[model samples]
Target: MFSPQGPSLRELCVQALSSVEHGYDLLAPKFDHTPFRTPQSMLDATTRALSGLGPFRTGLDVCCGTGAGMGVLGALCQDGTTGVDFSSGMLGQARSAYPNASFVRADARALPFDAGFDLAVTFGALGHFLPEERPALFNGIYRALRPGGLLAFPAGSRPPVTSIAHWATLGFDLALRVRNAVWRPPFVMYYRTNTMQEVSRDLTATGFTVRTVPLSPPGYNLVIARK
Candidate 1:
């Protein structure tokens, strides 16, 4: 489901075979044109949901790509926003796109900030982390936020086992496993890596009180956690 402006099949194949950071670097230029970018509708809904909860001062976007989530933070945070990503190419695009916002290249599991953000959010990035790695990621987010600060992200409900989306995701993850087994650097993006229950538990264990706000279009869940 890529547009004409998106990566070609050969380009995508090369990316899929590379490490996650390298793959994202290769895909960053066309990322917004692909289905990978968080949709504007979800963005708007998240903004609306955060409206009453915010008026936040400083915000951070974890794994922010081309800075789509920065738009939401710009509206919600008064002091400005920051977008952090491991991919240099993505951060480069983000810096160019949102010159007013700060962009940093850093690992989400070991964020550089210390209680520096009033709010934190992520979009379409969790699947890159293996389930076991989530605890560290959540802990880093919690440490980055001030006490009582919030962390938010949109998550999709699990697709039905019989649905095409389900089978497609399963096959994709399986293929990725096979590819990684033979590859030097592993690419880590799997649709089934994170689940609501597991994420909730991890967040709680990492000192966040989690809550879910049901989003529109029926399949989305907006998770808000307070540190």
Candidate 2:
């Protein structure tokens, strides 16, 4: 699932053994080459989906690893874009790719901004936050958005039990659970935790008016939460 330039299997093993922050720091240089990066197709689809909601001013990308989501904000926002991530190495790569955009190093659970952005987006990073941790993360994002601002992200339907994808994801999560049970620094990614019902409930509790629209492909939806 990786490109020629992506990290080697041994490198990935090392990363999986390290803490999420330090693991990402070590993988930053080769991250974009891996399947782990948000796909360009997904980004384009999200941009098209969010365009109609716009006339947005400054934008923020939470957990903006390598800044792929910034391209979506860049298209929809009239003002500048900013990317916030905890990994300095990832921020460095993002800064190099989008020099005009701002980058901040901060944990997503405790974001620093307060009502400074008209729009915000996050991609392929939800699984990093466990079910209990989502409250703090969502609360921070809610605080970071200006009144009448919007937060958008893409989410896919859960795969069926009979599907290969379902089993693969299940296996991955199970393996990670085992690893975390014995490992010091747990890599907190799981594929099944963030369901539409769960996320919408959380967003609603945070006072966002939540809604969904069909995206480019089937089984995927663009979640728009207005502040």
* Highest lDDT scorer: 2
Off by over 4 Å in 1: none
Q: List the residue pairs that clash in candidate 1.
A: none
lDDT of each: 0.92, 0.93
Work out candidate 2's RMSD over C-alphas: 0.9
lDDT of 1 at 65: 91
The digit string of per-residue lDDT tens for model 2 on 35-122 reads 8888798899999888887799999999999989989989988889999999999999999999999999999999999999999999
What is the Cα-based TM-score of model 1?
A: 0.97
Give me the displacement of residue 112 in model 1, in angstroms: 0.5
Model 1 scores what on Cα lDDT?
0.92
lDDT of 1 by residue, 56-95 (tens): 9999999999999999999999998999999999999999
Output the worst ten-in-a-row residue range by lDDT, candidate 2.
1-10
TM-scores, in order shown? 0.97, 0.98
Consecutive 10-residue window with the lowest summed lDDT within model 1 = 1-10
